[model samples]
Structures are given as structure tokens and as C-alpha cells.
Target chain A: MKPQGIKVLQLMSSRINKYLIISLQIGFLFGFYLVGGYLQKTLALPVPGSVVGMLILLIGLYLKWIPIQWISQGASALLNHLPLLFVPVTVGIMQHLDFFSGKSLWLVPIVLVSTWIVMGATGLLGQFLANRKEWDR
Target chain B: MMLLQMFFWLFITLLLYVVFRRLYQLLPYPFMIPVLTCTVVLVVVLTSFDVSYDTYFSGGQWIDALLGPAIVALAFPLYKQRKLLNKFKVEIFATVVTASLLGILSGYWLAVVSGYNEMIVSTIISKNVTTPVAMEVASMTGGQPAFAVIFVMIAGIGGAVTGPWLFQLLGISNFLGIGMAFGGASHAIGTAKALEYGEREAAISSIGLSLCALCVSLLGPLLLKWIS
Candidate 1:
């Protein structure tokens, strides 16, 4: 092939891959929203659309309609930003401190310390179970 | 001044994200540290400025709205890790359930001794679970749902930060054990952290966290009510 033709082909392939990735992330995000919405609307279930979307996506993967690598890149990028995503929520939590005034001020430390223990202990339990015999891989 | 305040918050948030991304690129242990650091910085800044939680929350809620999308996006990792998940479904469930029970009891007991009221105690009881599910548990048990959000975030952040290290400390050599524990303790945030290790781990963690949350939300409250 001519040099010019080779350069053009390379550019095209790179552009295509970039677009492909962008589409996949958008597709996953949108699919989550759609499934969440449809389920809530149809079933009148209390679960959020996002949660439902997650379940649907899980099924999609198990069914083999989508490949891992295809979704992994976009998902990881989002996961990395997971903490950032909650920044606003944390702020909101702080802002709502007034609601906890009076008898509620006592709730803060209790909630924080208790939650920490619960979260930590649960993590440990999961580890223990995984260590057991019948469950051992 | 108000507009400027809002601008600074947004600017700081984005800047922190960039800094975190860069740090992750440079550091071996990237994910947990960035999250913890960002949280601390936020607390300091908010307190220093005497920023009312309500004011900050109004601005922060804009960001909070995105959490749903981010969580739903987790499906991708679950998809990627399907093969491993299929092979280990039962084990994941057992571990997650046990973890969920322990997490709820320890958290509530600690909070009670610490002098928190009934509402606060109930809220923390299901803090590691998702907001919707947690809310259900809260209302059923006469806990406050609004406050449950705070408990949930704290629990999740705590789980995400300490989960991996704890596993290493415990000499947990198994992937299913590590992943399931993360889910049961941290919910989506922990699962997000797990996804970094591998797709299978993330998928299993997500499933474990969600299922445990569902069970706790439904059954936990009923148990509480019955006992009371």
C-alpha cells in the first residue's frame, strides 16, 4: 500500500476505536437508566432505576451478549471517579446538620461510629466466609 | 459572593478529581487514598468556611444526582467478570449474608454505647446498603431516612478505604472472600474499588452488596419490629 493510504487507514482505525469506547460507556449508562425506569414504571417497585439497570446489565454480561474488555474501560474510569461523584452528596449531608439539631446532634457521632464498625465488620465476615472449606475454590 | 461560593465548590471538586487522577497514575495504592483525602479536605474546607451543611448540600446534591448513573454503570464490570461469578455464586451469598449481619449489629451497638439516640442508631443499622433499601429499613424500624444517607455514605467510604487492607491483614488469599466482603460492607463504593482488582471480583461484590442490602432492608427491620 502507498504511504499516504497507510497513514489514512491508521487515522481511521484510531478514530473508530475512540468512538467505539465512548459509545459503549454511553450505552451502558443509558441502559441502566432505561431499565431502571421501565421496571419502576411497570412493576411499581420501590427499587431505583439504577439498581434495576445494574441487575439487567449483570444479566447481559452473563448472557455473553457483551464482552468484558468492552465495558471494563469505561466502567473503571467511572469507578475511579466514584469518590468524586459523592462529593456533592457529602456536602449535602453536612448541610443538613440543622435537621439533626436538638436531640438530633447526639445522632452524629453515634451514626458515624456505628456505621464504621458495621461496615468494617461486614467486610471481615465476607473474608471469613470466603476462607471456609465448602466455599473454597 | 453566593455565585462565587458555588463556583469555588465546583472548581474544588473538579480540581480534586484531576489531582486524584494524577495521584492514581503515580501511586501504587491510588484509589482509597484519593477518596479519603478528598473527603477530609472537603470536611476541613466546609468547616473552615463555616459553610452550612444545607448550603453545601444544595450544591452537592447536583453531584449526588449522578450517583445513580455511576452505580448503574457498575453493570459493566459485573459483565466483564461473569465467568468467575458463575462459578462462585453460592459462596458469595453465604459470605455476604454473614458479613451483612455482623456489620449491622456491630455498627448499631457501637453507636448506642456512644450515646446516639434511637433514630440515629436505626439509621446506622443499614448504612452500608443502598439509599433506597436503607431508607426502607429505616422507616420500617422507626429510624429517620434522611439521616440514613449520612450513615450510608460514611459506611461506604469506610468500607472502600479499609476493605482491601483488612483482607490483606487477615491473610485472605481467596478472591471470592475478598470481593464478597467488600460488597457486604461497602455497597457500591467498595465494589467500585474491587473492580480495580479484576472484573470477576467487582461483579461478585456488586451482587453480594445488593443482595445483602435487600435482605437486611426487608428482614432486618421485621426482626427489629418483632423483637421490640
Candidate 2:
């Protein structure tokens, strides 16, 4: 066989393997999500199952039970594209337009003011304490 | 026909999301944020076409379902931060906890002032957290998930835009302060903005974002109950 043909075959095989690994890791994420849902139903927890799933994964990873490689690709893939997932949910706002009408639109300025106030407060406190800690050290 | 319609909305959403995401990358403008832009464009298109949201969501729901696993995927980042978590846990915790509680207070106060109902108040309460988590927190607390997202966007973008200048204005130059303040207040977008400061700052920003998210998720319900 030509060397070029062999190289092309190897490349194609690696690509297939990469995809298989990605899909398998994604399957793991879904499995954790399901377990989270199950725990939520049985425990009647107020916390959302997905959030629970995340905590479980965090504990699992931290304790070295779940290797990072297990979900690195899948997790990064999902997180990177996470913003895209919200497009539909955000679009869902169209149904609730009446809620945004009337004086309720005051939300715009209210958000601007609150964000400024809260952000400013947090920054000042964080800066002060962190600098103090540096001085202590 | 039902199946075709369902596929159509789903396809259109994916198409718009991908194309706009590319454009956002090329443009990198604040208004070009793919999610906001896509939402605006899709909403306008659907509204002009006289299609009800329910009908559009018949297909869009497929996309929405991905949010569940995506939330679970959130753990990956927190896990990656194990080292930073311990090293700066004190500062991150001290500031983010206060920030989280204070953030909730601020939102609740404003909602009351604005005469918002319990539903809107609860929705507003989670505004400072990341989008997916905020949605979950809002839903768990009996707020509208969709409505919660709007506030998250406003807070995230608003923080990203104003935070750097705010920091420079106040002469707060420590990486810890820059990160914690931005992350606790702004979430993902703020963390992205922190990338300009440096990688360490971005790392701190991410941890701050997650810790604030965790605080808001766990303590948010009880805080709302106590404050309300």
C-alpha cells in the first residue's frame, strides 16, 4: 500500500476514536444528570436535580472517584456551547411580553442601578480585605 | 406536519445560533453577544410571522432540554479549581458569601420598590448568578425561568461593561478584588472580561462566579424567606 494511503487511514481512525470518546463522555454526563433527578424525586429536595448532579460530580471528582478525563471533553464541549442552549429559553420570553409592559419596564433602570450598587460594594469590600490579608502576610 | 414544524424551529435556532456565534467572534461587540442577539432576532422573526411561542417551543424545547445536562457539566469547572479553591477559599468565601447575600438583598429591595409581584421578586432574586443556575434557582423558588434569564443577561453584560472602568475608577487593582467583585456580581461574562486582566485573574473570577452561584443556589431560598 502507498504510504499516503496508510497515513490517511490512520488519520481517519483517530478521528473516529476521538468522536467515540466524546460521545461516551457525554453519555456519562447524562447518566449523572439522571441520578440527580432520581435523588431529587426520592429526597424531595428543593434544589434542582441538575444542580445536585453538579454537586455530586464535584464531590466525585474531588474525591478522585471520577477521573477528570471521564468528562473533560464532554464537559468543555457543553460548557463552551452553554450559551447557545439558553437561546430557546430566552426566546420563551416572548410569551411573557405583557409582564414587561407598563411601569414594569422600570426593570431596565432598576437593574442598572442595582448592578452598579452591588458591584461597587462587593469590589470595595473585596479589595479592602484582600489588601489587609496581604499586609498581614 | 407536526414533526416537520418541530424540526424546522430546531434547525432554525441552531442555524441562527451558529451563524451569529461566528459573527460575534468576528465582531466581539457587546451587543453582538450571541445569546442576546439570537434571542432578539428569533423573537422578532417569530413575532412577525405570527407564530405563538408555544408553537415555536414545540421545536425549541428540544434545545431547552440540553440545559439539564449542561448544568451538570458545570461541575467540571469547579472541580478544575480545587487548588485555587483552597488557597483563596477564605477571601473568595468571605466576599462571595457577603456578595451573594447582598446581591439577593439588593434585588429584593429593588423589586419591592418597583412593585413587582412575588413571582417577579423571586425571579429577580437570582439575577446575579450565572444564567443556567439562575434559571434553576428561580424555577425552584417558584419564579419564571425565562424571566430570570433576562435579569442574568442584564447583570452579566452590565457588569462586564462597567466593572473594569469601575475598578480603575475606584483604584481597586488587586487581582483578587477584580475577580471576586466581577465574578460574584457578573458571573460568566464578567469572568470573560477578567481575561483581559490576566489568566490568574480569570481563574479567580471563575471561582468567584461558581462560589457565588453555589451560595445563591443553596442560601438563596432561605435568604429570600428570611428577608421577605
Candidate 3:
């Protein structure tokens, strides 16, 4: 076949696979929804469907049924946009700014400091665990 | 006015996405800066325009609704790290329990010193979890879920921006340390950032973060009630 013919074939194949990628992502989302619903109903849990679906998908991946790279692309893309997902939430926080007036200023520093300390300590602890012979090997 | 707010959100969203894509190319981890900065800018701009959060929030809730799904997807990374997790289960278990306990105590202690009332203090305990969990904990404990969500958001944005700097200042360089710091401080969003840097780090961070939140949700109220 001519180079153009080969080029066309490549384009066609890529296009077909692109849809595959999107379908898989949607499938993962749906799986999350279904499982989330079941967990919510059966367990009387607050667990959402999407979360359960994600766990299911992760299990599938860990078992080697699903490739890490396959979902990683889509997952990373969605994860990258995490802030956008919370835009409304933060704006809502701004809405409640009045609640944090002079009286609440102290809370910010306290939360900030404690958050830093706890996080810092946890981080160091993780490192310590990782370095331990029992964990490192 | 609602339409205008939606347009504003859309505009900011597009601009931020484009800017973050560029920054990600240059920096090892640039997502937090854009995310935190965008939040600050968006809130400032919206408030300046005199748009009520109700109007802005309703417009933005479309994204907020997806927050739960986004977080649940983190199990993928958690799942991916099973080997490492298995290797460190004992340590991970120990660390998680301790981390969660410490996280709750420190958070509450700080809230108390910060002069927050009982209701606010209850909300602080759940601030480490994802919105849905935090909201549930808040309602059950008699604190405002709305307030908890905001405090959580502030913690997330604050942690995402400051996490890296704090690590460097503390001379922490291991990926595990970095990931835990991000997860512990910022929860899911921070874990997402950790994943970009390294898989092991991301997994540890993700587990550490969620575990801490769950522990806090259970213990925060108990401690608060006892103290009061």
C-alpha cells in the first residue's frame, strides 16, 4: 500500500481506539455508580456509587485484569481537574466568610498550625515505616 | 445574575485549565498553585461583583456533585499500590491509626485554641475527609456541614499550596514523606498531586489521608463531647 493508505489506516485505528478509551472511562463511572448504590442501600452507608465503582475498578486493576497505564491516563486527567470540581465548594466557603470574622480568626491559625504539624508528623512517620527493615524489603 | 455567575465560572474554569496545563509542563508539581490561586481569585472576583454564594454555588454545584466520584476514583491508585501496601501493612496500619489519632487531637486542640466554639470544633474534626464524608460527620455531630465543607476546602487549598514548601523547609525528600505530607494535610487533592510525582508516594499518601479522615470522623466528636 501507498504511504497515504497506511496513514489513513493509522488515523482510522487511532480514532476507533479513542472511543474505546472514552467508553471504558464511562464504564468505570457506571460501575462506580452501581456499586455505590448497592453499598449505600445494603450497608446503610453514606458511600456513594462512584466511589464504590472506583474501588471495584481498582480491584480489577490490581488483579491484573486491567492495565495501570490504561486508566492512568483518564484517571490522571480527571484528577488533574480536581480543583475545578471543588470550585463551587470553595466559593461556598467564601459565602460563609462572615462566619469567620474577627471571632473566628483564631481558628484559622490553629487549624493551619495543627494541620501542618499533623501532616508533617504523619509524613515523617511514613518515611520511618518505609525505612524499617520489615517494610522496606 | 445566575446566568452571569455561570458565565464567570465557565470563563475562570477555561482560563485555569489552560494555565495549569502550561505550568504542569514546567514544574514538577504545579497543580496546587493553579488550584489554590484560582480558588482565591474566583472567590475574590465573585465577592467583589457582589454575587451571593447561593447564586454562585448553585452554578458551581454541578462540579461539586462530581466531587464524590472524583475522590472514589482514588482507589485506583490505592489498588495499584497493593504490593507495597502488603509489604508495609503492619507499618501502614500502625501509621494510619497513629496518624488518625494525632490528626484528630491536633486538629481539635488547634480549633479550641483558635477560639472556635463547640459546633465549629466538631466540624474541624471531619475537615480531613472528602466533602460527602465531612458533611455527614458534621450533621451527625451537630455542627454545620456547610461550615465543615468550607473549612475542609480551606484546609485543602491551604495544604495543596503549602505542602511542598513545608516539606522542603523540613528537609524532607523521600517520596513517601512527601506523599504522606500532601495526603495528611490536603486529603484527596493532595494525594492526586503526590501520584504525579511517584506511585508509591501517591498510594501511601492516599491511604494515609483517607484513613486519617475516617479516624477523625469517628473520634473527633467523641473527644469533643467528652471535653465539653
Candidate 4:
């Protein structure tokens, strides 16, 4: 076979395998999500099912019930493309234009100030704690 | 033609996001974050073209469905950071709890002071937590999920943009401090930005957000009821 033919074959085969692995990883993550949703329904937990699923996954990985390699690829693919998923929801802001106007004009400044306040206050406190001589690791 | 048009919006979203993402990578500008840019452009295009939100979402919902699984995937990074988490457990845990409480209380106070209605107050109250948890918080606290999302976005984006600068101004140089700050205040979106800073920061951020979500969910309703 020609060198070009061999190169093409290798590319296709590798790409195909990568896709398969990624799909499997996504399946594993979906399983966790299902369990989480089930638990949420039964327990009436305040936290969302997806979050609960995440905690379960963390514990699974920690206790070695789940192998990191099984989910790593899928997890990263989802995480890296995470922002893309939120695009639709973020665009939902169009429906609520009324919130930015009339009596709600204050929403802008309030959001801005409170945002700064949270980050600034936590940031300052985090620094103070990090610098403490006692907790030094 | 109808089928093509149905898929057209989805195609446009993917194309725009890829283009903007590539551009952000090359330039690395903070405000030009792909999510922000893509949403802004999509909204402008949809509004100017007189296309309704429902039409765009006909295709957009496919992407939206993935948000749940992505939430589960958050465990990956948190697991990776198990060592550091174990070491500084006290500090990280304390800071995020404080962040959740402060963020809710401050936002609540501002809305009350502004004389906004009960709905607005509820929506803004859970703005600190990630979207999933924030939505639940919004509903429980008598806010609209839609409005709560906007506040969450604002908080996340604001924290990502100002976080580093604020840390610098406040003299917090450690990655742990910075990551905690981002995750504590902004949750998922902030953690996403922290990824650009460093791996350690992103890892810490991942856990920071998860814990923050839990804290806000458990405490948001109780706190809101007490205050109001």
C-alpha cells in the first residue's frame, strides 16, 4: 500500500477508537446522573440531582469503585465543551428583558455591587487564611 | 425547507461558538469569552432578524440537555484534587461557606434596599451558586428560575473578570486563595475561567463550586426566610 493510504487508514482507525472510548465514558457519566436523579427523587434533597451525581462520582473515584481512565476522556470532553451547552440558557435572557427596565433598573447596580462584594470579601478572607502560619502545609 | 431551517439555528450556534472560541484562544481576551460573545451575538442576531426565542431553542435544546451530564462530570476534577482538598480541608470549606452566605445576604439586602418585589429578591438571592443549584434555590425562595440564571451569570462572569484583580488588590497571591475566591463566589463559570490561570486553580475551583452549591442549597432557604 502507498504511504498516503497507510496514513489515511491509521487516522481513521485512531479517530474511530477515540470516538468509541469517549462515548463509553459519556455512558458512565450518564449512569451516575441517573443514580443521582433517583436519589434526589427518593430523598427529597435540596441539592440538584446532577450535583449529587457529582458527589457520588467523587466518592466512587476516591474509593476506587470507578476507574479514572473510564470516565476521564468523556468528563474532559463534556467539561471543555461545557460553555457551549449553557449558550442556549444564557440566550433565554431575551425573554426577560422587562427585568432590566422600569422599577428593576436597580437590578444592574445591585448585581454589580453584590458580585464585587462577594468576590472581594471572600478573596480578602481567603488570602488572610492562606497566610496564616498555623495551617501551613 | 422546514427541516433545514430547524437545524439552521443550531448550526449557526455551533459555528459562532467555534469561531469565537478560536478567536478567544488566539487573543485570550477576558470579556470575549466564547460563552459571553456567542450569547451576545446570537441574541442580537435573533432579535434583529425577528426570530423568536422559541424558534432558536427548537434546536438549542439539544445542547441544553447536555448541561445535566456536564454537571456530573464536575466530579472528575474534584477527584483529581483529592490531595490538596484533604490538606486544606478546613480553609477551603470555611471560605466557600462564608462566600455563599455573604453573597446571598448581600444580594438580598441590595434587592430589599432597592425596593424590588419579592420575586426579584428571590431570584437574586441565589445568584452565587451554580445555575443548577441556583435554579432550585430560586424556586424554593420564591424566585423565577429564568431571572435567577441571569444573576448567576452576572455573578460568575463578574467574578471571573474581577477576581484576579481583586485578589491582587487584596494581596492574595496563592493559587489556592484565588481559586477559592472564584469558585466560592461564582461557582461553575468562575471555575471555568480559573482553568486558564492554572491547573491547581481549576481543580480547587471545581471542588470550591461543588461545595458552594451544597452549602447554598442547604442554607439558602433557611437564611432567606430568617432575613425576610
Candidate 5:
């Protein structure tokens, strides 16, 4: 009940509040993900649940039902560390070692060339369209 | 006891990833990206110790579980860029759809021509999309989901590493174009690389990545059915 005791209590409460906020933000994200999974299962949608979750969140933002600050910290934290989530899956490649043998020799070249073609085509077309709109102005 | 061991190994995996991520930044090489280095280190350690992936996954699935939430988090960036997206919506959609189609067809044709089997071809065709979507499409098309993931990783990492150089070489200086190319061709990994260019580039890349996934998921099964 002294001044120092009250000050320490306030600091502890503030720290707890910060943790509570982050948990809420993360909960909101996972809530959307669960809803997405439900939709994917019930509706038989072609899209993955995560993409559907993203769309739902985007719509919520657009409708102003969800404030950006509520989720920004949590979302950015996840996005920043996104690649780490993929490490286990990447390591799963070892399971497919047999497939990488003689018959699959062309996998690398095919993937590389296809990616290059897609990139070039998309970039050129997008740039052309943007430039055309500029000239129209 | 099992739960404690799982947590311990998972912690080790995460710690190693953080260390390698820092190393990658300090070294700043394309091949030294955290995911690649972490996977390699873990693989070597696991193999050396004779640990199976199933055991590792028992621990590592916690990180994997976040993939869904991380993807959903993309909405925040997409929301921030809504205005720019609205302005170029039609052009962006068209470019992505066209490029995705091209990517699919080219990969399929090349794989078939190179004497690969139907499953391999089907898997490779969906490699431009994000991992989950690619896996779904692969499953639907009778392709191996694991193979699809491998191909997707190759596409993503290759695109991320080469995208900037390729764009410069082609004289495509527009941020929108660069972002689209990276996203449409490489998916999430390329989008991450695009972030290095700037926020605008990253935003557009996110759009590109999502749109590419949408197109591939909707069209992939139909295309496979038609091809077969």
C-alpha cells in the first residue's frame, strides 16, 4: 500500500495488459482461420482455407468491421517469421529422394524455365498496360 | 515425458533457425536464406542422429500450424494497398491470370515432352501457386502432394533469387510489374524477396501471389481433367 508497492503493481498490470492485447490479436487471426476451414469443408470450395480466411479478413477490413491496429502487430509478427513455418515442410523433401533420381532429371530445368517465362510474360504485360494507361492521360 | 521431449527438440529447431537467420543476414547471400540453411542443418542433424521426420514433425508441427494464420495475416497488407489495387485491378488480374496459365501450360508440356509421367507433369504445373493451394490442386489432379511442394519450393526460391536480376535485364523498372512478376512466378518466397525492394513492391507482390493462387486452384483441376 506504499508508493513503491503501488508503482510495481501498475507496471505488472501494464505488462499483463500488453500480453492480453497480443493474445487477443492472435486469437482473431486464428478465429478467421477456423472459419475458413469450416467454409472449405462445408462449401467444398476450390480455394484453400487460408486463402479464404485472408479474403474474409480483407472484407472485414474493407467493411470497417475490424480495425487495423487490432491485428497489425500480430499479423506483421507472423508475416515476418513466415519462412520459418515452412522449414519443416522444406525438410520433408528428403522423403521424396527416390523421385529425384533418373526420371526426374528435368525437374530443375522445367521449373526454372517455366518460372522465367511466367515472370517475363507477367512483367512485360503489366508494364505495357500501365504505360498504355499513362499515355491515355 | 514425450511431450517434454517434443518441446525440447522443437525449441532446438527454433533456436537453430534464429541463429542461421542471423547468420544469413550477416552474410547476406541468396543461398544462405534462413529457411534453406535451417532445413539443411536440421536435415543433417536428424540424419546424423538417425531421427525420423515423423519424430521431428511431432515436435515441429507447432511451427507448421502457424502457416495457416500467417497466410491469413496477408489480409493486413492487402488492406493497406486496397487503393492501388483498385486502380489497377483489371490489368493486374489479367496479367496474373495470363501468366499463371502460361506457367502451368509450359511446365506441363515440358514435363510431358521430357518423358515424365502424368503425375509428375500434373504436380509441376501447379508449382507457381503457394504451397497449400498447390498441394490441394495436386491432390485433386492425381499428382503427388509432396512432389508438388518440392516443385513449388524450387519455383519460389528460383524466382526470388533471379527475379530482380531478370527484371533489370529486361528493363522492367516499374514496381507493379516487378512485383507481379515475382508474385505470379514465385508465390510467397518471391513476395518476401519483393519486400526488400519496397513496401509498394511488396503489396503488389502479395496481390500477385493471391491472385495466382486463386487462378491455379480454380483452373488446375479443370485443366488436368481436360488434358487427361
Candidate 6:
């Protein structure tokens, strides 16, 4: 009933609200994953369930069905920790060390050169188009 | 009981990852990427202790499970930048398509010319996109998803490492171009690096990454079929 007691009650309520929003965001994400998995299994789509889940979330946001504030906090938290999730797969690369042997020696060079080509081509092409409008103006 | 042991060991791995990640940030070397460093450390520790990848993955798979949620979360950032998407919609689409096509052709032809198997060629074809999409494309095209992951990581990490410098060397100073190049070529890791430049670069990078994935998913199968 006192001022301190009221303040404590407000803080607890706000904390609970924060946790509630996070749970809802995660629930939505998991729901999409389930839908994607179902589609993949039943339809035999080539797309991965995760990619389908991503599209579902994107459509939710675009259609205004999902509030930004509802998902932003949990979403950003997941994105911030994204690299950590990939560590297992990256480490899993160690399991296939033999794939790099013999003729596969070209694999590294091919990946490196293609990356450079893509970067250069995209940069140059984008810059040219971006500047073309300016020059025309 | 076995599950408990797996959880305990994975917890240790995660703890070591955090410590090493912080340590890598404090170091000055560009090659000292946190993920790569943490991976090397975990692999060494596991190998030293004779822990098989399967045992480690028993618990590690829990962390990997979050990847789907993390990807879905990307929609938030993409949503925030919707205005930018509208502004540069045509240019973004154009650049991504061109770059993705270039990447696929270069990767595929080189692999073929090098006399690698069809599987290797297919894996290399999807290296320009993020891991999940890349793996899917690889599998759809009859390649090994594990091999695709390796190729994707190499492309992503290599692009993140050298992207800015390469752009500068090529005399391209436009942030749009740099961001697009990073996203189209390197995927998520490159986009993460691009975020350091500013919000605009990050937004454009996300666009590039997504468009790259879309193009690969749609065109990759057709291209492989035509080539065969």
C-alpha cells in the first residue's frame, strides 16, 4: 500500500510484460517452423523449412499481422547471437577434411576467385547504375 | 545420464566460445575472426579429449536449432528498412540478379573445368548465398549439404575479410555498391561485417543477401538441369 510497495509491484509487472512479449515472439517463430516442416514433408519441396519460416515471418510483418514491437526485441536478440548458432556447423566441417584432398584442391581457389568476381561485378555494376542517374541529372 | 553429459560438455564449449570471442576482439589481426577461432579451439579440445563430432553434436545440435529462429528474426531488420527497400528496389534487384548469375556461372564452370565431380560442382554453385539456402540448393541439385556448408563458409568468410579492401582497390566508394557486393558474395557473415560501416550498408546488405538467396533458389535447379 505504501510508495515502495507500489513501485515494486510496477517493476514486477513490467518485467513480466517483457518476458511475455519475448515468449510470444519465439512462439510465432516456432509456429512458422512447424508449418514449414509440414509443407516440406508433405509436399517434398526443395526449399528448407527454415527458409520457408523466414518467408512466413516476412509476410507476417509485411501484411501487418505481426506488430514490430512484438517481435523486435526477441528478433534482435536472435540476430545478435546468430553467429554463435553456426559454430556447430562450422566445426562440423572438420568431419569432412578429406573432401579437400586431390582434385578437390581447386575447391579453395574456385570459391575464392568466384567470391572476388561476384564482389567486383556487383560493386562495379551497382556503382555505375547509382551514378548513372546522378550524371543524367 | 548421457544427455546430461552432453549438455555439460556443450556448456563448456559455449563458455570457451565466449571467452575466445572476446579475446579475438581484443586482438588486432583481421584473420582472427571470432567464429573461426572458436571453432578451431573447440575442434582442438574435442580432438585432444577424443570426443567424436557425433558426441559433441548431440548437445551442439540444440544450439544449431536456434538458427531457424535467428533467420526468421532477420525479417525484423528487413522490415525496419522497408523504406530503403522501396527507394532502391529496381537497382537492388538488378545488381543482385547480375551478381548472383555471375557467381553461379563462375563457380560452376570452374568446378567443371577442374574435373571435380557433379556433386562438387553443385555444391559450389550455391556458395554465394547464406548457409541454409546454400545447403538446400546443394541438396536439391544432388550435392552434399555438408560440402555446401564448407563452400559457403569459405565464400562468406573470405568475402567478409577482403570485401572492403577489394572495393577500395577497385575504386568503388559507394556504400550501396559495397553493401550489395558483400551481401551478394558473402551472405550473412559479410552482411555482419557490412553493419560496421553503417545502417544503410547493413540494410542494403540484407537486401542483397535475401535477393541472392531468392535468385539461387529459383534459378539454381534450372541452371543445373540445363547444364547437365
Instruction: Indicate which candidate wins on TM-score.
Output: 4
DockQ for model 3? 0.54
Can you write out model 1's per-residue Cα lDDT over B1-228, one digit (the tens) per residue? 777667667777778767865776688473435566676677778888887766666556656656776777777666656666666667666666676676677666777677777776677778778777788778878888887777777667766766666666666646676667667767776776776777667777778776877668666776555533
**Candidate 6: which pairs clash?**
none
Candidate 6, residues A1-137, lDDT tens digits: the string is 69999999999999998878887787777777778767867887655676667777788889999878778887876676666777887788778768779767669988999999999999998888878855876
Candidates sorted by DockQ, descending order? 4, 5, 6, 2, 3, 1
Q: Alpha carbon lDDT of residue B228, candidate 3?
A: 67
Candidate 2's residue-wise lDDT over B60-161, tens digit each? Answer: 998888777877886776677667667777887788888898888888898898788999889888888887678888988889887787788778777877
What's the TM-score of chain A alone for every prediction? 0.69, 0.83, 0.67, 0.90, 0.81, 0.74
Residue A7, model 4: Cα distance from true site in angstroms = 3.2
Winner of 1 and 5 under DockQ: 5
Ranking by lDDT: 5, 4, 6, 2, 3, 1
The TM-scores of all predictions, comma-separated, are: 0.78, 0.82, 0.84, 0.93, 0.91, 0.87
Q: Residue B189 deviation, candidate 3, in Å?
A: 1.9
- Candidate 1's displacement at residue B47, Å, is 4.8
Using Cα atoms, each model's DockQ against the true complex is: 0.42, 0.56, 0.54, 0.73, 0.71, 0.63
Ranked by TM-score from best down, the candidates are 4, 5, 6, 3, 2, 1
Error of 6 at B7 (Å): 2.2
Question: What 10-residue stretch in candidate 4 chain A is worst by lDDT?
Answer: A128-137
Candidate 3: give its CA RMSD in angstroms.
Answer: 3.5
lDDT of 6 at B48: 84
Candidate 3's C-alpha runs over 4 A off are A1-16, A46-51, A62-73, A134-137, B1-8, B23-32, B54-62
Which consecutive 10 residues in model 5 chain A have the weakest lDDT in total? A96-105
TM-score of chain B, candidates 1 onward in order: 0.84, 0.72, 0.82, 0.91, 0.90, 0.88
lDDT of 3 by residue, A24-78 (tens): 7645654665777688678866433554556667777768887776666556556
CAPRI band of model 1? acceptable
Best by lDDT: 5
